[model samples]
Target: MGKITGFMEFERLEEGYRPVPERLKHYKEFVVRLTDEQAGVQGARCMDCGTPFCNSGCPVNNVIPDFNDLVYRQDWKDAFTVLDSTNNYPEFTGRICPAPCEAACTLNVNDDPVGIKSIEHAIADKAWEQGWVQPRIATIKTGKKVAVVGSGPAGMAAAQQLARAGHDVTLFEKNDRIGGLLRYGIPDFKLEKFQIDRRVEQMKAEGVTIRTGVMVGKLPKGSRVTNWAKETISPEELRAQFDAVVLTGGAEQSRDLPVPGRDLEGVHFAMEFLPQQNKVNAGDKVKGQIRADGKRVIVIGGGDTGSDCVGTSNRHGAKSVIQFELMPQPPEQENKELTWPYWPYKMRTSSSHEEGCEREFAIATKEFVGENGKLTGLKTVQVEWKDGKMAEVPGTEKVYEADLVLLAMGFVSPVATILEGFGVDRDNRGNAKATTDFDGGYATSVPGVFAAGDMRRGQSLVVWAIREGRQAARAVDEYLMGFSDLPR
Candidate 1:
């Protein structure tokens, strides 16, 4: 987009991260950003194709070519403007999103895709460095109030948009901090807490009231913030107090393996293990911190959550880490022509795997064996997929030594407590039920109540959550004021 022959002339270059040996010592972000000159060269690799599939691939539909052109010219401020116009938090997506945009890049049909994510990262970082990133206080008060539940990317985006549209927005969270999964579920090695903190600060400055440590409806003992209000507010109170309500509470119900020794001490959910380490990294004094040091960790899942456990256990100096997946291994290389502008089925070995991990595919845990209420090992069996179902192979059972068994199996649906607490209709998959069609989009069966993000649409990427949040804001605004200028 920068030069007529730019794509042909320049080779793509990506930002470098620190060496794993050095980075494994601590949990700080190890990613090395591209220099302005390097980023400019990468930007020049954009072909500006007749149709940019990157736009369709990106959940928020970012103007990839325009931003690439602006970065090539070193107009970082404008780049951020263009990026922020679509994405509410480029910083989050820049770090953790799978970047379907890159997979859908036209350049990938032949060679490596243009470094779109890195460029977006560079633009956002430069904007903040130059203090160009600022809160947009509403110019006029709309005199309407809105209650947004949860402070994850979705809730944050919805709150910011509604506030910018002059709504008195109050974002509530049960946790002591602001972010939902971004605060706790995500390990610090991938994304530091300060990233969430910085964005939360901006949201606050933009006229959004972030009320943390305040659980809606009923909370079990020890769930309340010690310094905040003591009692839980009913859903009826919230509806009465606010002009509209948006439920962005994330899907947090972790799927568990109901095998023998499921209730053992060392056997834990990924959420239980991941959150404790994150809290410790944030300087909290956890009484019994989850540690994998000198322990054989058997992580039962092969997705991002399992990879995170591998990385965390490596950082904890674990004796060994083994990951198991129920599905058979995918082909390493996809049929490029067949999968060319779409996400293809292929095995993805993460950076954590690079650190150290024994990956076992098509393996399912059969039973957890333990002594004295503590998990010690697990029995697994290899299976093959046939006729759209898995069939266990005869004589495929094996015992894997495990001092700690982390069920990294993905979440099933939104945690029922809060969703049920609000009495909202749910889909068959247990997510909040809502439609995205223009007429009453995001509106739940409950009047004046809306749902979006993982809570509404199962677990997904941060970028999708942001998109849902922004669109849901427009829906809420329209429901309140009869029309909304907020971008969908």
Candidate 2:
């Protein structure tokens, strides 16, 4: 508590963004960061409540109050130390996380919450500038080999942790580079590839072997999810070569819109369209890439992915961009009294949404209307909830012209073939079946095999992925040495 009265004296100030006109012309990060002094002021606004719900609200259980106090006192190094203790990738979370911690902030109940995410961003950037972010090499070698399949946040965190614990860790990725989704799934306007490259360099310096363009197991035939694997190693070979294997591959099976004319040309899955642009941004030439230029684009599904499509389409100079949500629009703000200390349902206008978009809520697509195998328009109807069931309005059926349709529905589960190759049991939801308990947690039905992140819990936030990775690392460590000294 650097300043007990600071919360009463200060109002919340969010980070700024570049002007939309200027930012829309390029595919780079546009959000302006908080200066050191601004971060200090924001940190001082923390009330340092007895419960400190922001800590629990954060997926990685960061010591929020301690970092806030440290930042408020101008102890920047200590602030980074506290933040890095819980989160291995604070930069990623600071940039992209929805900040559920803010929703659970004690001050949020009666006033604006402290700008914790902005302060975190400032601290992480400052730490990097000051050369405080360096490789932490283990002192002793354990003579144990651990194989981590997938180079996303979870796999990276687990590989780093296991390497620091003196185990020989090898990380495998199917893509030509590291960072499973971060490198390709996310747009460069949100997160640049250099951030991932910097961390990859650090991980390599920490003695972790990173193998790219190598798939750990076979993908199902005709699967469309991104994969540049020129070589595939059998699961049995991995189990035989490594002391333990950790599965951190993310859920890649996108949920499809199986309606009439789904097979029409110019209609594509969000993954199919988004990754091409990302590849182009990385200076790779893509053949017959999906373009939105001068086209009437309709993005189905209302979520982050859909919002991303909106942004990318705008960048592509699409003629018009429209987004549809089947659910009713939420309130602009949540009732804090009723939803305090938990993630609340409220209308969230992302930076992408603010750029430009026509949002339609309580709407459902009836069928994709096409002519001669190319998409032309779609038939839709307004819907209403009656007794918690969806019912289409009788007279609200309408048609809208469209040149391209991007289905941004979220992913369903991990690719089935990889899970099947390892013989890992699956949950009812089709995710890898594994527990998060302290005793033998993250262990699959098969011995010496583990699962974490999206592979175990289905698609979720990056912060959640890091949390699971750290916890799974501790579990794997315990399994290896009969006990673990690593933090969970």
Candidate 3:
């Protein structure tokens, strides 16, 4: 809208990355952000589509066109304002989100879409630099207390919103620090920890009480997932102490491959391996941390987590890194005609994949071959999908040597113990049972307990988690006061 023929005049310019060799030596963000001039040019490419499919395509329903127009006009502050209105953590999403909004851009039909994420990143960074992002403290204090269990994006969003709504909000985290997955699961090479720490400080300034190393419920014994909780508060205590409780602990149960040799010493879940590196990057001393140095590492699963493993392995100076995908390789390019205005299925090569990796698609592990309680290799076979069923190809069996195997399969659901502790019903998928209704949405079968984010919706993107958190905050506000003015 800022420039009528701007879309035709400017070609899409993507953000650059540091050289692979230089970046691999350290764990730090490598994305080169767009300069103001570059961002303005990218903003100019936003077509004034009537429908604005990108808004709907974004999980948080960001005002894309408004921000694009603001950027095009060089109104950086207003651009940040529009972006912050919808997304509580643009820095997080701008760095990691796959940018489905771009995929749904109208210009994508016949040309390269606008660089929306880069513009967002620029806006957020500029906002921070200009001191536009500051504490929004509530003037009036409601004589009510709320407990948010989990310090991930959903819990953080809910706590901030509720606190701003004049309610006393306490955020509990089991780990020693805030930011559930973002602080640990994601590699620093992609997202630096200081980004999360700055937000935590801002939340504190906003009057949200943060309690780290505190578990709201008991963790199952022998749980391998990370937990540094020094004290556990019973669910009954939370219900008795707080007016309401929001469960945003996220799905921590990592899916496992139950083939033989699963108990091998070298076999580990991606969670176990990832958190150690994050902790190390944070300058914490970890005992017996898992390392890929000089090891033939095999990462199973073809999702973001697997890609992360590949990157970390490369950083660890692994002997060789190989990734296995059970599904067939997707097309290099999606058919836009059939998939326009929606997320398209296509081959995605992450920065980690580009660094170095041997990717094997449509391969299934038959068995883990090991000796003396240690993994040595994997017996796999190529698989094909026929009639909606997977079958191994005849004479396709092969074995690959491996010194270590990391299971990067996605999570199945939240740990049942926490949900059961709260006496909340679970969906068929084992997530906490809760709805997103305006009147009483986010409320569980229990009267005062509620759920949101990955805990209620199963594993999902961070942007979706923030959306659920904000909507759930409004639901909780309405539940408390019989009405709410907070935006959903």
Candidate 4:
């Protein structure tokens, strides 16, 4: 610990956001990161607890205390070194990841947890600004070739690791752009696209071959999920060329609400709506773009995706935005004594919510009401838990006018085409079936195929994707050379 009693002397300080009015006019990041002094102070707040629960709490098992001490001592480079050792993209996680590590912090038991995410953001940004982040080109070329399907976080991490391990790695993406979900799913106001661009450039410098606009497997016919592939490679051809294949694509199968009027014209999946805005932000033209402008928008689902819809709707100058959550609202605060050192169930309000969103909890949409094949409104009912199931309360039916309905429900599983193409086994939930065993983990039933991230574990956080990617790289490395020195 850099300062034994420093925790007692400092209070948590959060990063600031630009004014809502000014930020809504453009799709750019509004978060004002912590300055170096503020980050150092935040680092000082890391207590000298014997067990660093935060390390275990983080998906990648980052060396939290070491980086906190390094940051506290103003050793920015070493702090970044420690951070980079674990996370491939601190910039991505620092911006969007909900810090589970903070919830598991010792201080969170009674006091505010150390601002680990903010500190990591500062360190990552400083590292980039100081040119500390550069290409780690391999000096030795191992003769193995690896194919990474999907250019999202997991695929990107795996490709970079295998490339650095001296293997020829080619990352394939269906979209015209490299980043999978991050390139399209997330709004630019939360995470700028340039962040991904720089990393893509770095990966290229490290000898990873990036092949965008290339689909290794077919997408379902007429699927609305983003795909701009100009070329297609059969699974057999891919497997023949690469010594190992890693499936790191996201779970693109969005859960749908199959109520009445689901065929309405203005009704859409969050994926269908989100990617268009991102493409527009990237200067790509989309025909008949779904806009929330002057529309009464109803976003169903209470997760991050729903929050993103709210934000994007506000940016579109929507007339009104309402978000519905099927579950009852969680308590504003969690009972620390009972839930310490673990993620807590509590009310979470995003910056988007604060920007102007009427959130309705314990509410379920009964039916989408429309006329002339266009969404006009929705019928809803107040739900309550009876015994162990949600039951609609009597006399609680209501209707709300809405011009656009965005189903922000989370994804159920990965698209079936890729798994079918590879002939890989699927778990009960339809995710690619694989184990995380140290000896031969991330390996699918197929001999040379591996699966990781959302494709293997279902939809999850970016940090989890990075962890899976790095570990999968190790598994592939060992499979190729009969030994691997890569970190798991």
Better of 3 and 4 by lDDT: 4
Residue 204 miss distance in model 1 (angstroms) = 1.2
Q: After superposition, how far is residue 254 of candidate 2 from its true place, in Å?
A: 0.4
Stretches of candidate 3 off by over 4 Å are none
Give lDDT for model 3: 0.93
Kindly report which residue stretches of model 4 are placed more than 4 angstroms away from their true locations once superposed: none
Extract clashing residue pairs from model 3: none
Q: Cα deviation in Å at residue 8, candidate 4?
A: 1.3
Higher-TM-score candidate of 1 and 4: 4
* Per-candidate clashes, comma-separated: 0, 0, 0, 0
lDDT of 2 by residue, 382-402 (tens): 999989999999999999999
**How does each model score on lDDT?**
0.88, 0.93, 0.93, 0.94
- In model 3, what lDDT does residue 5 have? 87
Model 4, 233-332: lDDT tens digits are: 9999999998999999999999999998899889999999999999999998999999999999999999999999999999999999999999999999
Q: How far off is residue 161 in model 1, in Å? A: 0.7
Per-residue lDDT of candidate 3, residues 1-488 (tens digit): 64778899999999999999999999999999999999999999888778999999999999999999999999999999999999999999999888999999999997888899999999999999999999999999988999999989999999999999999999999999999899989999989999999999999998999999998888889987789999889999999999999999889999999997788889999999999999998889999999999999999999999999999999999999999999999999999999998899999999999999999999999899888888899999999999999999999999999999999999999988999998999999999998887668999999989899999999898889899999889988988988898999
Error of 4 at 101 (Å): 0.7
TM-score of each: 0.96, 0.99, 0.99, 0.99
**What's model 2's lDDT at 268?**
90
Poorly placed runs, candidate 2 (over 4 Å):
none
